[model samples]
Target chain A: MRENLLDVENLTIKYKVKNGNLFFNRYREFKAIDQVSFNIGPSETLGLVGESGCGKSSLARAIVKLVGLDSGKVTWLGKDWTSSHASTDRKFRENLQLVFQDPLASLNPRMTVSEIISEPLENYRKDLSVLEKIELVKKSMETVGLSTSMINRYPHEFSGGQCQRIGIARAIILKPKLIICDEPVSALDVSIQAQVINLLKDLQKRFSIALLFISHDLSVVKHISDRVMVLYLGRIMEIANVNDLFSNPSHPYSQALLSAIPIPDPIREKERKRDNLVGDAPSPIFPPSGCVFRTRCKKSTNICSIKEPREKIVKLGHRVACHHVSDEESK
Target chain B: MNRLLEIKDLSVVFDTPDGSVKAVNNISLDVDRGECLAIVGESGSGKSQTFLTAMGLLADNGRSAGIINLNGSDLLNMQRNDLNKLRGNRIAMIFQDPMTALTPHMKVGEQIREVLDHHQGLGKKAACEIIREMFNKVNIPEPDRRMEMYPHELSGGLRQRVMIAMALICKPDVIIADEPTTALDVTVQAQIMDLLNEIKTEIGAAIILITHDLGVVAGIADRVAVMYAGSIVESGEVFDIFYNTKHPYTLGLLNCSLSLEKKIDFLEAIDGHPPNPNNLPNGCPFNPRCKNVRDICREEKPEIKIKKQNHSSACHFELGVK
Candidate 1:
């Protein structure tokens, strides 16, 4: 069997909101991640594409066990990490690492670059000497295209892109198999963004690391991701190869998104008709009962409102969650 | 075509302790009446700075040189008070972040009314009536109830609509939108663009769209100016800039743009950072990152060569690309 780097099945994360008269009433549960399942193979890049509050970050945190999962199984190399095994799972921490969205917020301002990179190494490998930790920190910094002499500098001294490189160096110090990079380049300037993207691609090649690159930018995802999963309101709308997803987007939401891209050419732009989704995205506190996309979906019908559309394989590997597309194409 | 706003050799400089930073170098462009001119560039490429400087909206430390003519009247030559009077009344600017732009302490109705009170001869009652109509034009639901709410009470999309409402309340002749929808998500961004397009057509005002996203500029802009390091490296009809791009920087930018088209495994990134404004390179600002860099591009700065009737490019290899 080909070794799957990581497998997250039916993962759900719900935060408890404490309100109503101090300690009197029961706390309400806010479901951030609503039953999502996906996997990353060895040396493969699986993109998790979603908007601001679609629970992409929450799913990343659940995989790292930084946040508690309401229910689901996260398996790494056939080892189950759920309930009893989650806390005791030592391999999970060593194999999985996460880089947060904001570089400035993720990094500790007080700590120097050397200390930030070496922190993980110190925690994971207690047997290693202090000199060895220093060597490893220097090596990882070089891997992310940072200089060793600059290691003594604080996080505040570096630019946004430089700070992200430092963050990547810190994550890779442990040599984790899977890295969940959550909007790593979103906060960066456009020109600096390209630099960081190229660096990530290079590191991914050198380390043979599986990346769960989460982003709202479709362009960035299309460039880095092997396969793309489009999410809307904590539900997967379409899952296909990057080429197929971009070229032949079957789902209406994906089509709308793809059409929304402003072509630099005015004539071509005028020719292309974009069906802008109506109204603001509904609150996730109490999402639509049927298909989550029905509220804004142009093709949503009675069947969609009554029952959630089943995930069907449209192409060899492409999966879509749409009744209209599935039914029309199937015939 | 009659020109609505013509900017000639515009240069905006901010005097700092470090030195004079040329935010917007000697650049010139014209926006015809009812035409949408998109100034496309990345952050610090001087897209917003050009319009801000021309409008006399820059802070005290900032200073601008050259002519900014609105129907032959030198806007730059006008008095500071006159400039302020002409600002919201004639040439209105809408910023990127609407949440921060709107007053959190004041009611939405009162805020929009203040624009009318200063620009137009209208009292609070008359202004309130006009404000509700503007809100309806922007397609804000519950316009009556919304006027009572503060900035914090509305959603991001709603806040942006309110900003649009305020900018269009006086029915300005020119609308300068600086990345109006950049902060919002993709879906909401599309809606905002549609709304802006609708407003432009209904109001029949010239628009200056300043943004980094090429996709957003595609449908709206009539002409496009590709800026790099505070200068217009390429300017032409939007169709020519996108399809028949002359400049290598413009081509690289289009290639880098994420679109509906399935890109190859690797993206074509323009190699280096945009040249620093304060410490700009001697020759071409895009020389370091440009792939088609020649000996001439490295040694001497290239002048803007008029390729077609309206198309212009400042590159050694302008005609080399198809």
Candidate 2:
């Protein structure tokens, strides 16, 4: 079996939300990520998908140590790096990187392309000379398909697609083993989105980097991911191989999400029957009892609301967390 | 042909400090009653500007030429007062972000009431009745309670529903929805698209959907127009544009976009970025990135030509031919 690059175990993240006026304020814990567990094998792409408020971003931020974890463990290559102090380790920081959603906003407006790309090197590679750093930055830019000549220009000078390339250049400058991308291409146009997706795929193949890709667009996730995880209201509804999840989704939430994606073919789009889920996702602050997706699930029953279903093996590499699905599996 | 809205040789230019920017090059298209025409393009392709010009909502630095004929009336040359009377009454527009488009301070019901009061001269009680009915039609839960709540109180999906309700309250002949589902989630987007489709058939109002998402276009659009560098590169029936594509730019767009229908090893991204409007290429705007470009494409600009019945493309060489 392939070695696991990153292993997340029963992770839970919560935010303290203050309610009422300053005089009578009460802090309530809002669970953003609840008891989620997964493992990413070396060079594997795992797509994390859910609607907004489903904790996809929170999970990403927690993994990168941007947010404090309420409970659980994050193991990086057999080393425990869950604490905030462990994230400060230079080796761990260099081996793990993150690409943000908004390309322009994530980049520093005042910094030039070369400066932005070389900042990570300055943080990690203290032994490298200035000339070597410059060469590395140029190489990274070339790898992401940005022109090396435009290194002196500011982020504002570049287009959206070019700015995104600069972001990728900065992320890959350290040659991280894993890159957690949070809605990376949601802000870009369709055509530009394709370009960035291709670049990521190319870089993954060249460097053998594992990716924890988080996105609301199912079509994109399906294109780049090897394994797919479905989340709803901060809870894992299903985890399966990409082919299994797409071809035979057992969880109700996954089925709804897969069916909701609009196909590009006009003839197929018209004829295909859509199983649209009714009502918006309930707020994460007060998620439903037992199964978080039970409120919106069409096949939900009394057992789903009364008891939280444990993860059950549906097949060799497929697991689902739903009372209804578990019952069917047993039968 | 029962054309409800017709735009003829329309062009929009902006006088920027650096130079003149040709935002919307001379282009013409029309929408018949009950038909949905989708304009697909990247950010600066000028899809939004074309309809904004038709709505008489251009920026101060922007100047528009040519005629926007809506039901035999030239909207481009109309007076400000006359245009205001026609806007939101005969023509309605739904924006991408409902939060910004809606009034934050006013009650949601009062906002819809204002549209009715201004256009139909309905009193407060009559407008409230109509507003509540519109709410029910758009599938908003608890229409009575929702009308009194502020825009912030509602969810993103509900706020979008309110926007749709306000746009439909006017019962206009044409509705120009600009990236309406861009701000929504996939599930909510599906809901909104279904609602829009149902409303289209129910009211028979022509819709002009301006978006970059080809998936959304394929679901609802009767005709598809692909724009590149402010000009339409291809326009045809939805099936023709998706299957029998002619323009290289359109073909690039389709090939590049990832679909849920199937998976491919690698996407064929169009090389190079879209050309800047102020400094477009001398010949074909897409020649620099086009795979089928030839020496002639670098010398002379290709004019829009008919490729098949009810289909047209602007390219030096037809695609799929050696």
How does each model score on TM-score?
A: 0.91, 0.98
User: Between which residue pairs do clashes occur in model 2?
Assistant: none
User: Fraction of true contacts reproduced, model 2?
Assistant: 0.76
Superposed Cα deviation of residue A311, candidate 2 (Å): 1.5
**Native contact fraction, candidates in order:** 0.60, 0.76
Q: Which number leads on lDDT?
A: 2
Q: CA shift at B123, candidate 2, in angstroms? A: 1.1
Tens-place lDDT per residue, model 2, A1-331, is 7779889999999898987686898888988998999999989999999988889999998887878898999988878888637545667878889888999999999999999999999999989999999999999999999889998999999988899999999999999999999999998887789999999999999999999999999999999999999998888989999999999999988999988889888998999889898989998888888888888889888987989889988998899998887667668
Q: How many residue pairs clash (N, CA or C atoms closer than 3 angstroms) in each of the candidate models, in the order given?
A: 2, 0
Candidate 1 deviant stretches above 4 angstroms? A18-27, A84-91, A126-135, A147-149, A247-250, A264-267, A309-318, A323-326, A329-331, B294-299, B316-322
Tens-digit lDDT track for model 1 on B1-322?
6788999999899999998899988999898878899998887889888888778878889889998998767898899888878888888989999888887899988888888988887998888889888888898988889999999988788899999888888888889999999888888888899998997788889889998878788878888999998889999988888888899888888777666454565667777667678888878888888887777777888878898889999987745652
Model 1 CAPRI rating: medium
How would you encode candidate 1's per-residue C-alpha lDDT over A1-331 as one tens digit per residue? 6778788887878888765686698777777887777778988998888777888888888877878888888887677776646556665678788888899999999999999999988778999999999999999999988989998999998878889999999999998888999999888766678778888888899899999999988878888999998888877889899889988999988987776666555676788777788777777777888898898888988998999887778988798988888678768
**DockQ of every model listed?**
0.52, 0.83
The predictions' CA RMSDs to the true structure, in order, are 3.0, 1.3
Instruction: Compose the digit string of candidate 2's lDDT tens values, residues B1-322.
Output: 7899999899999999998899998899999999999999999999999999999999999999988999988999999998988899989999999999999999999999999998889999999898889999999999999999999989999999999999999899999999999999999999999999998899999999999988999899999999999899999999999999999899899898889877899898888889889899989999999887789999999999998889999987878886
